[model samples]
Target: MTTWWLMRGDVRVGELRQYGVDQPTFLCHFVSGPGWEAVRELFEAWAAVQGPDPDGSRNAEAIRPLMDLGLTLHPSDGGSPLTCFKGCILRIYGDRARLRY
Candidate 1:
């Protein structure tokens, strides 16, 4: 399993986890915060495009919204696999974070 942190600047807003090898399942858990609605919409859109399997071309399309929101993917440091998957990180834009405040 791989766990990714969804961060808005210094604050953490959500998490994503990937499980399985032959058939990987990605789960996203996000907290209520700025741009939450947009994020939710994007998730829904992604799901709609995903069909039965998440590893589809639409997956890339789904991630585009996140990038537009200034979210970048990063690799997390070494951690317990039971607690978190290794090398998974996503950060929200600082500018967007400030807008929420």
Candidate 2:
């Protein structure tokens, strides 16, 4: 299993868990934060685009807010995943911290 922590500075905001190797599925959870509303809107927009076969360009636009928020994706065991969104992966060490996400 591969876990990615979404961090804002020293605080944890969300988590993304990847399961399966051949057909990977991501389980994501996000917490309420200073910019929760904006994040929620972006997430909803992303979901709308994911109705069927999501468009890569539209999906990129949808996740742009998350990137702008400086949310770093930290992987467990200090190793990078094979694939990721926008190629935005920031490796960090340590166990999973407790947070709303």
lDDT of 1 by residue, 1-101 (tens): 55455544554445544333332323333344453554666655654663555565666766576555544333255543221112332322321211110
- Model 2 lDDT at residue 10: 64
Q: How do the residues 1-101 of candidate 2 rate in per-residue lDDT, one tens digit apiece?
A: 55665656665655655533332324333334453344455555655664554556776776676567665556767765323245543221122122221
| C-alpha lDDT of candidate 1 relative to the true structure | 0.42
- Give the runs in model 2 whose Cα sits over 4 Å from its true position: 23-38, 50-57, 80-85, 88-101
Using TM-score, give the best candidate's number.
2
lDDT of 2: 0.48
The 10-residue segment with the lowest total lDDT in model 2: 92-101
How accurate locally, in lDDT, is each candidate?
0.42, 0.48
